[model samples]
Target: MLADRIPIADALHGKALELVHEHRAASVPLLERHLSIGPDMAEALLLRIARETTVVRRVQSGLYVYTHGPIGEELAALHGFAQEVLVALASNSVDVDQLRDAAGRYGFSIPHQAAGNATVAVPLCLAQVVNV
Candidate 1:
């Protein structure tokens, strides 16, 4: 059978996704019971699911939660920072320093790359923030 040809690890991951999305639960113990897997295997499969997809996140010790989106509607307000930064950029002909300050005021610290020791990096997070 083609389904039988699939490896157990991959099959476990698929079933786990189905269960999480269907039931809104990612309980390791539940998966262990359903799949006839022990705790260690269940833990490993859960870790694999997390690394391969964003559908599940460990919200507490030994507890996993299913997430429908990367960020929920409750965090809708946080996106304002990105929007505000974009507005400031669109409204200004500001220099690099001003841009950095504007982004900082919006609560973002742009990442910097160093070419030499003790050198401050460029505030290139400007591009990231705008895209955000």
Candidate 2:
């Protein structure tokens, strides 16, 4: 089931990055248990995963932590965008003028405020309609 949700390459590599960020350093058995990976494949997967992500540092003789540089920066930027949009939307219904104001304040031009409104509104409407 877990395999179906995420691509194998991402699951192996991305999950390792996530684990290192969360646990700092982990052993083979621990990683296997946490990720539900077989012992036979654990070492190879760990090595492959570690090769892709940034190594923060070695915490122990045989343990290391990993993180992604581009992904981290992208997530931070996305969080900032979401926060600004939510704050603006929370104060009042989002309209073209308000989104334009927000875009200016955020140092960018969202010239397609109407298009963005439709994009956001469709999901909101769907959530209400589906009771999600």
**Among all candidates shown, the one with the greatest TM-score:** 1
- Those runs of model 2 whose alpha carbons end farther than 4 Å from true positions after fitting are 1-8, 56-132
Query: Which runs in model 1 stand beyond 4 Å of their true positions?
Result: 1-8, 60-62, 70-132
Model 1 lowest lDDT segment of ten? 115-124
In model 2, where is the ten-residue run with the lowest total lDDT?
A: 118-127
| TM-score (C-alpha, index-matched) for candidate 1 | 0.47
Model 1: per-residue Cα lDDT over 25-112, one tens digit each: 7777877888787777677766666657667666647577675564532233234544655677788743455555555554555565
State the lDDT at 11 in candidate 1: 68
Q: Which pairs of residues have clashing backbones in candidate 1? A: none
Determine the C-alpha RMSD for candidate 2 after optimal superposition of all C-alphas. 13.2
Error of 1 at 109 (Å): 16
Residue-level lDDT of model 2, residues 43-127, one tens digit each, is 5556556545444433447564443465444444444555656775677654555544544554443334554542222234422
Candidate 1: give its CA RMSD in angstroms: 12.4
Give TM per candidate.
0.47, 0.35
Give the Å shift of residue 74 in candidate 2: 24
